[model samples]
Target: MTNRTFDEMQPGDRAELRRLITADDLFVFAAASGNSNPMHLTDTDVDGNGTAERIAPGMFMASLISAVLGTQLPGPGTLYRRQTLDFHTRAHAGEEVIVRAEVVSKAEGMVRLRTEVTHADGRQILTGEAEVIAPVEKFDREDVEVPGLVVQRHRHFEALLERARPLPALPTAVVCPNEAKSLGGALLAARESVISPILIGEAEAIRRAADEIGADLGGIEVIDVAGDAAAAELACRLVHDHRAAAVMKGHLHTDDLLKPMLDKAHGLRVGRRFTHVFVMDVPGHPEPLFVTDAAINIAPDLATKMDICQNAIDLALSLGMEPRVGVLSAVETVNPAIQSSIDAALLSKMADRGQIKGGQVEGPLAMDNAVDMGAARTKGLKGSVAGRANILVVPGLDAGNMLAKQLAFISHAEGAGLVLGAKVPVILNSRSDSPMSRLASCAVAAIRHFAGAR
Candidate 1:
């Protein structure tokens, strides 16, 4: 550790830190700063778009200057007063850059420094001047490691918007929004242009709840139904009549809304069995995991599991992923007593025999083997979907629900729930879910609704 005091510092003293740029560095910077510009994110150079090559934000590179000043130059007890910077060129990814700061002048309490950043080739990128109040006393402290921050930039929301940009917002009927979370989510989605919500519930109660949540219901369509059952029926009726493109589960129980969708006469069922999928963006997972049957299909048999697997695969394809299915079990071996392992083996065979299509399937795998290649190798498991499986098809609803909730609560994931295999996608959000989660569900449903139209 280096420490510099005002008494020890002389004019023209300099300190420099050198580092190579990395993609993770750029991503972390973007995440921390909430800069979602495509020019900084994408690899392919947009031709004639008047943007430079895949570049990191100028301020991101300049932050290294602040780091050098506070941590090394005036060293730790320096308070940054002001900074003036000029960026000459875009600092791109994969380029080495050096940050240099030199003490230019020192007043009684204020110290001014000249700062500049240059490429490995000595091309100037940024030059700045920083004035700081240096510590007079020996303000000594032991060096500590800064904890890594999990900057969830909400990249999931951006990706969803890319798919949703061209399509029109879905006319969605939100069933039985008796509380703030449900009603507020729908209103937020509508505000974001993701869903054109037709709020279906008791009008006076809905308005009161909306007031409590500070959501304006003016100019928004609201169907005044007497109770939860009637609201569910009307929501289903709207979808069946093509008046609404989707139905969303609100404050009521999932069964309350789902029952109307299962009706033979007026339900939104096509020829396929309805199931649920939770799209999860876990912290360290390289890709989003499509978790299936988490909210539906309790203890499904082989045939029903097949439908569940196919439904997940279809959703993955809609999102432009050639999904590798991992049929998870307690252990990576078929046993006579454990029915999950048996079903896993059967699903694998079904994929091989062309009974289940549109995904690469491998199964009879424990959680570790399904997700970790090293674990898979250690267990002598060799298959395409063994380690790199992005879609997790759990044994039953209990297992799937637990796994998805663990990823959401324990790992702090961004989750969106949707019902697949229906005539229209059902945006499903729990009463306790965040507004962002609900908005994400609406985006997924809108994308699925438009994709289904094709």
Candidate 2:
């Protein structure tokens, strides 16, 4: 790897560092970097009004600076002297931000410069000045091949879905088996794992649907339920009675399923808030990104958020991440007006003080500053998880849902959902989700089950 010092930087040079702020990116940054600000993106309007608005992390601005300073300005092998910055406002994805730098002075082996990354709206996100030392002459280079990155998932949907195979051997239960698509998804999941299928619903309808979908039902046990209400009850009973290790939802309303699953007596409570998280894989990002509460927990408070954070951290640890969390918000600084920013700071300090463990927490950061080290450097932010974040804790469900859908639909990202903070893994996916996403969700759920059971 080529290390960069700040010497090769020049005046009047400008470049754009390509960063696609997909939902996965936003989710990861929010957890790993701690910048769950309101301005990143909107998930849902509380009144069902319209949309959600979120601010990009100022640390993202700092990350852009590092990108320019190291990759563009100094052209590598440049020495970093010092840098300072201030954020004037917020920025978000779908908006373009440009980083510009000018060489102010050239002295004995030293160059002084000022730089800023701003939104197209002309608002300055971050402004800073720096001193760098670089070689006057350039190093010789030979045109040679560089190794490519090894990928675990990509455009191949089937391969990505089957990455983790031979799922669970325990019998699994499907709740509210009214919707054919939901039953189909569950059936597909069954084929991938050793988990025997126990269909809890209208026996006649379930069988007819299975025939239409061409799914086998020979070994599947079809439990007849009188109606949606009875079906919902039976699904939870299966889990509570130790008939199944996992529960899958079919066609009933989310409330219908949640009611029985969370009945306190028959509920699958793990002594913490139950939440939904979608593991995302964007094209540019190398690994899976987890976006949470997208389908559950509308507006989580700080304590619930702590549970959410722990849940995401637990999934990352399961997926082999040492676990770094970024609490997201509109700005990287604590603002009295915004509870999210204040909470982000408290959580960061909490992580430091051992109140929250299993990861490095930083925030009050925007989205960009969370993932891009270049943005971190330009803004002169030094923290544990500023540039390299492993988990993202979103402020609310609106942010989480919109972020996940945007990446899954608008941008090219894989959405693999799993419900964490439970005694066992839960694959609760949406009908709008792709089959591969459904399969990947099952994979994550099954792997968690297998690993936890051991």
Give each prediction's root-mean-square deviation over alpha carbons.
6.8, 17.6
Residues 25-110, model 2: lDDT tens digits: 45556776877664553444533446555445667667677777665566556668888988787666666777877677777888
Tens-place lDDT digits, model 1, residues 377-401: 9999887888899989998899898
Each model's lDDT? 0.86, 0.70
Instruction: Give per-model TM-scores.
Output: 0.77, 0.64
Structure candidate 1, residue pairs in collision? none
lDDT of 1 at 337: 97
Regions more than 4 Å wrong, model 2 = 1-163
The number of the candidate with the highest lDDT is 1
Model 2 clash number: 59
Q: Candidate 2: deviation at residue 404, Å?
A: 0.6
